[model samples]
Target: MFDPDEIRGMLISAAQQRMALTYSEVLHALGHRFTRPLMRQLCKVLDAIDEDGRAAGEPGLAVLVVRQSDGLPGQGWFVARSGSHADLPLDWEGTEARRYVEARQGEAFDYWATR
Candidate 1:
């Protein structure tokens, strides 16, 4: 069984350390290498974490997990945003996308970096 809290704790630790982790880095932290199944399950757990955080009025933790090349969350994060991401552009590309992503990531860092 996947321990969501374990992953949550790792994300929190990353926030505490004030840094974003690549998907592979997160998997390695959990003692697993990169795999499609693990990545999917990890995204599911991260979505749940974001939901719980939203309920508690906290920044999304999943923003801290991102692509290694671009340092941006995967497409799932954008697609899952019902209306909470209205501020972001529709196309979700270029400087606008980078600013939006960095803002969200900054929220997570600022919220948890000192806590």
Candidate 2:
């Protein structure tokens, strides 16, 4: 059974490796089956990080992006921090960030496809 801290740690490790994981990828990494409740719990962990960042007046430890994928329910990208870097703007609306995230997503897709 995976706890929230374990999930969070996995996410951070992925980020350190410079990989942007989707909900499915995260579950796969943890050897868990996909389920609605599990997805919700993962989102809650991301949200908690966001809330903590807001309360502490800092940037979030991760960023979540909602993306459309036909076969996946609640498809999105979760990117965690790699290291010391500039914090995203507190008022971040994701318009500018999406470009980078999408590019990375494409790279991830290409990588797995080739493997």
In terms of TM-score, the best-performing candidate is 1
Residue pairs clashing, model 2: none
Question: Relative to the true structure, how large is the alpha-carbon lDDT of every model?
Answer: 0.84, 0.50
User: Candidate 2 lDDT, tens digit per residue, 10-68?
Assistant: 64555455455567676667787767687777776766765564586543334432322
List candidate 1 segments past 4 Å from native.
none
For each candidate in turn, the TM-score is 0.90, 0.50
Best by lDDT: 1
Query: How far off is residue 97 in model 2, in Å?
Result: 7.1
Whole-model lDDT for model 2 versus the true structure?
Answer: 0.50
Candidate 2, residue 24: lDDT:
69
